[model samples]
Target: MITLLRSRRSIRKFTGQKISKDIQDLLIEAMLRSQSSRNIRPWEFIIVDDKKKLEHLSKAKQHGSGLIKGAALAVVVIADTNKSDVWVEDASIASIQLQLMADSLGLGSCWVQIRNRMATDELSSDQFVKQALEVPDNYSVESVISIGYPAESPKPHSKENLQYDKVKYGSFSKPFYQD
Candidate 1:
């Protein structure tokens, strides 16, 4: 698992290949099994595969979104705020799980943050996704994950690139990077 974690990289370019139902189910299962605060699991997944919808979603944000149009599918992670106070954290965990699972399945995935962000037209990113997907008002969009077969291969993060300087022994004052 550590190796997998070390090698995982965000894939922003994808091929025209399609993902099978089994793979999609596995990714969903990963999210469903993710740990959440108090185990409330106050999250929902919205899968968008339609080309036009994906195009619309690509425009939902000004940047870090164009890749969705090439991805085979996009998973919109959402949470019911009323169901859990830590809904954002819960949804975020699930999103990472989904990305990791995609990597395990030899697929590629990248996360596009939506919560507390704005679209190109000044509309809230969450609201834009809700309007596009017809999501209920009770739920808030946390992120949108684009998944597909990668077109560009990115090298895994090397140990030399690790930010060990950010580590602290016990408290913030003891940071490894004295400077």
Candidate 2:
């Protein structure tokens, strides 16, 4: 399990293969099991399988061009803004769990952050996305996740690239456990 978790990497390229329904269900199950703040779990999921809509969403979202071309499925994870402030955090945790589960299931996935109106300087924006998906105004699209079989194997992360000693700590600078 640790090896699988450590080996999971963001895959940008994918073959034109379709994902199995069973695998999709497993991914959703993993997502459902994710921990939520106060167990509120204020999340709404939208699965985009339509080719035309995927293309449109790619244009709307900055990092979703790959989603249009490579993904077998694109999941729009929305959080209810009207709900608790922790809703966003809860939704985000669920998204991460889904991605990891997808990886374990021999699927590739990438996270595309959905910036709010304040970040983009367009107050009435995201209306286009909402209208396209037919999502209620109370919900805000938090992230887009693209999943598919990988076209190419991801490059392995180097041990030199990670500063595990600095991150692990017994007391700040002190190492938690000496290697």
Query: All candidates' TM-scores?
Result: 0.94, 0.86
Q: What TM-score does prediction 2 earn?
A: 0.86
In the predicted model 2, the residue pairs found to clash are none
Score residue 93 of candidate 1 by CA lDDT. 94
* Residue 176 in candidate 2, Cα distance off native in Å: 4.1
| Model 1, position 54: C-alpha lDDT score | 97
Best by lDDT: 1
lDDT of 1 by residue, 105-128 (tens): 989999998988889666888899
Candidate 2 residue runs with Cα over 4 Å from true position: 63-66, 117-126, 168-179
Best by TM-score: 1
Clash tally, candidates in order: 0, 0
